[model samples]
Target: MQTSLNHYSQNNEIHKDIPGRKEIIGYGLGDFGYVLIWTLVASFLTYFYTDVAGIAAGAVGTLMLFVRLWDGVSDIGMGILVDRTNSKHGKARPYLIWMPIPLAITTVFLFTVPDVGMTGKITYAAITYSLFILLYTAVSIPFKTLLGMMTQEQHTRSMIGIVGAFFIQSSALLVNMITEPMASGIGGQLGWVMTGTLFGVLAVVTLYITFRTTKERVGFVPTAKQEEKVKLSSGVKALFKNKYWMIITLFCISYYTLLGFVGAELYFAKYILGNASYFSIISLVKAVPGILAIFFMAPIVKKIGKRNMVLIGILSIILSTFIKYLDPTSLNYFLIGSAFNGFGKGIFGAMLYALINDTVEYGEWKSKVRTGGLVNSAASFGMKVGTGLGTAIVGWLLAFGGYVGNLSQQSDTALQMILYLNIHIPFLIAIIMFLLMWLYKLDKIYPQIVEELQRRKNE
Candidate 1:
């Protein structure tokens, strides 16, 4: 028989209440709220810093480095803080209520490049960027932790991943579609600020619905002797040593980096595609599979196994990316290649969190310690680091290319470098990521881990 099947275990010890379907959907919006601002930043912020705001690319990149560095350190602290929390709504959910205001303020101002001289501009960028990272930490830690309590069953967790992925990708599509054309018509600063504000408000409603309606069920229960002494440091240390977790951390870093690396297409869509409307068209093509993937993605994982699905995705990305590299000027080749890339990304993105939930269970099974907050935060920290690094590299490379936006005249070499940065880098990174993931051992081994956990519960 399947030794890892928890299909028969009693619900009480594992969890209290089954999270409602409504709660699952609503909580998704909250998670999406965090990502909406992030998507906006990713889609337009580099263009904003160098083009509209008139900031130097090198300096903007430096500011990003500091912000992500802060993000990395804060994740450790937030993980600890979550462990110490003891609210009625549960440990991780409380921060959802506390984080929205700071996120809104910092994000709005981050877009507002002041008329400071070079010195003032640098100072403005530094302060705003730092605040953005801190607030992002404050919001995202709580938001990611919600997945821990959403479902105890493996299948149920996978379903949540599907829903959440749809929202995140859909938002990304909208951001990519709007950023340039809107900027062209309304101009830069207002275009980004208005878009950010509108999306931020929408995200707030989603998060609030999640907060007011969601329930926490699967929390760590401390034993009598250990009840009072469960400190954050303990959780942090336990998370670091986890083997399954080690694989996950590496996976997230690679996966997020791969995605950001693809973001170079924003520039390609802007300049080489010959118009901003092509961005929306390409994004729509990309998003269609993303929409459909959510419904079938979970079942695909169940049938093929998670590791195999990841392998398939990695291969698809590699092939599509390389194809784009080989035939850069043909729209037919590019469109087909991009569709495959998007389809593969859609599959993987919708499913990575499901893999994370499995890792959390594996960690609990092997280590006899629970650290959901630590688990989520560490992964998120890796994502933020990747995002910051990706954007910074884009900015720095643009500076190197000497590509000046809205120029009455353009240099041939500078334009060429911009195209190269837009297309070539993402293609190369996606290839490297495929090879790295080929080394992943966790998903194939997870069924064995699941069997062990069920046996312990059954016995």
Candidate 2:
């Protein structure tokens, strides 16, 4: 049972805090649009660089590493900016409206290869990809920050996160299903350009819906005297002091690094499995199980808490990673392993943002400062850093394994390297994530934190 729409404020003050069907659907669509373009970059961009755009593997790896690292650092700056912003649309929601058009434009530019020589190619990629990531930070940090403002109830936030995750994975699955064949059938760079354009258009529309439907209801409003004293720097210092935020940030890094390995899975499907179409099958197996898992988690999450659910998911990931090795050549084993992996990722996708939002209350309770943007932004920084590192590592490893693009057959070393990425590395990451989740005891004390914050608000 959850509480009603009327929520409490300072001195037992009451306000209507509404996050109903419209809000949930609008919120989910935001991520659904985000992942449409995000999946294109995460799963296929590296492949596009090496195979279609004619960049060397090492160059692509180095390029992604630097750009993504900078992108992560930029998130902190964006967070700070978001905290300071005041508008009719509220702090975070305005960004949902302001940034998506440029974001959509950059999405197309990322897949477009300029007709130039090798050096020129690398330079072009660097510029466009950097712009893409920066714009992503601009929109994404603000969108995530809105989660805390929409409502104070943990269960409602979790439900929003769950619906958002469903859309995230569903969009990823859609991209995987269509991207290769669509690009292949259309032929040449034109194919990718058209696909990127379609996703970019969709991104602009869905995010606008989010901006229109959601409202900021739970942000902390300071007294006149307190407002004069509050500094952004102090809020940042508070975030670092937050032990729970640190733990979850690390967890994000590990989880996304595991996602980075996904780039190599295409190579595995192509050379090792000897079937390009297996990539689609693999995507199907992975996504369907994860999507299904999301439906069942809400009830369990309500009872046992998000931390426990994540622990269970990590264990599933670990088991799935090992299962792939049982008979590496068997497609059945890969499909089964993918099923387990997707289920775990589904749980993670549903819960990670909600958990980050929880830390906002924790931070305010501990440090007496509420930083919705900074908190979400810093955590998002960890995610992008992990994504950058993961994607870069894939490029580095593939190069080390003597991989070449558009080859009829890759070397035995390349095959071995791909296998290690798909199986060994992810297993180790799952173990690391599991340990981090074990350290998270926040769910047990979150109520006390909330109660205390409310009591303080009465002062």
Candidate 3:
């Protein structure tokens, strides 16, 4: 009778369907807002600073590095806040409702460079950018934390993550394809201001819909004996002690660092390809493969497991990037390589959050405390560090290689550096990611962890 009861309890835990299509779609829409802001910063912010704001490349690099370090530090405080939050909408979801307007406003300010002297422009950039990152951290940390709160079923979490990836990539694609033309067509600084405003409004609407439609089903409700709040240090310690969390955190750092290669595409198109608008075609090619890859992601993950699938995807990116590096001058080769890279990116991007969500469970099962916010925040910290480093590398290298903004043609040296930044750096990062995935053994142990947690819950 006890055995039957245990089996029934396990089945009940596994089969809970509180998050259906409405919640999944709502969750996915949040990424639409996220990627709109993120892609704008990642793909165009440096360009705006250099060409429009007239900041030097070296200064831009130094500023990004400094700001992102501060940004990463701030994530810990945000994580603590999320963990301690008690609200009608739950810990993470309320941020979705309350913070989007601030986020949108800050995003607009980030793109709005004032018509001031160079020092004034730099100061303006720093202040607005810092505010934007802080607001983004408040909203994004919660949105990511929401995934773990919504469901314990790995499959359901994976589905939500995959759908989120689809939306994120789609939003990124639209931003990439249109941003240059939109900015140029509108003409000058005013054009960028308009573009930021347009997306800012969209961000507000989508985030509100996400807040309205999604429900948090699996928040940490402490037992009477465990009611005291967990210290931030304890949460951080628990996160590092979970081997899988460490692996995923390492992978995210490497993955997002590789993604920072997008920052160089505008330079590559303008200087190397000899057409500023070629970036649109490159983005379109890259995005389509990733978008199409989503259709196959779930079945592939189920068949091969997330680790193997991720490994396969990383391998594809490494190989494709190497090919692009070998013939950097050939547009056909670059496009082909980008297509493969996009496929790999699609697979990895879709599965990444699901993998992180698993680590939340692993930490909980081992530590006997749920540190979902801390775990996700730590992951965000790593990503912010990687992004900062990547952007800094590009900026510093451009300065070193003598890149000048608004020049019709670049020196051969600067063009070569753009090629290296656009291709080889990403390849190296992917190799590191591949090594990190090899160290991950969570896929083998996750079922045991889940079953054990379920058993403990029932007892």
Tens-digit per-residue lDDT, 400-420, candidate 2: 989899898998888888898
Clashing pairs for predicted structure model 1, backbone only: 4-450, 4-451
In model 1, the Cα lDDT at residue 7 comes to 30
Off by over 4 Å in 3: 1-10
In candidate 3, what are the lDDT values of residues 1-459, reduced to their tens digit?
Answer: 112112212366765745777678888898898889889889999999998878988889888888888889888789889999988788998998888899888988887788788789889988998899899999999999999888887666777777888898899998999998999999988889899888888988998999999877776565664578888778878877898888888888888878766879888878877787988998988889889878767766766778888888898898888778777877888888888888888887788888988998899899987888888888888888888888888899999889888888788788878988988778778889999999988877888888898798777
Can you give the TM-score per candidate against the true fold?
A: 0.89, 0.96, 0.96
* Local accuracy of candidate 1 as per-residue lDDT tens digits, 144-203: 777876666665666667677777777777776776676667765776677667777766
Consecutive 10-residue window with the lowest summed lDDT within model 2: 1-10
Point out the worst 10-residue segment of candidate 3 by lDDT: 1-10
lDDT of all predictions, in order shown?
0.70, 0.87, 0.84
What TM-score does candidate 1 get on C-alpha atoms? Answer: 0.89
Clashes of each: 2, 0, 0
Task: Give the per-residue Cα lDDT of candidate 2 at 309.
Answer: 92
The C-alpha local distance difference test score for the whole of candidate 2 amounts to: 0.87
Candidate 1 off by > 4 Å: 1-16, 220-226, 229-233, 408-412, 444-459
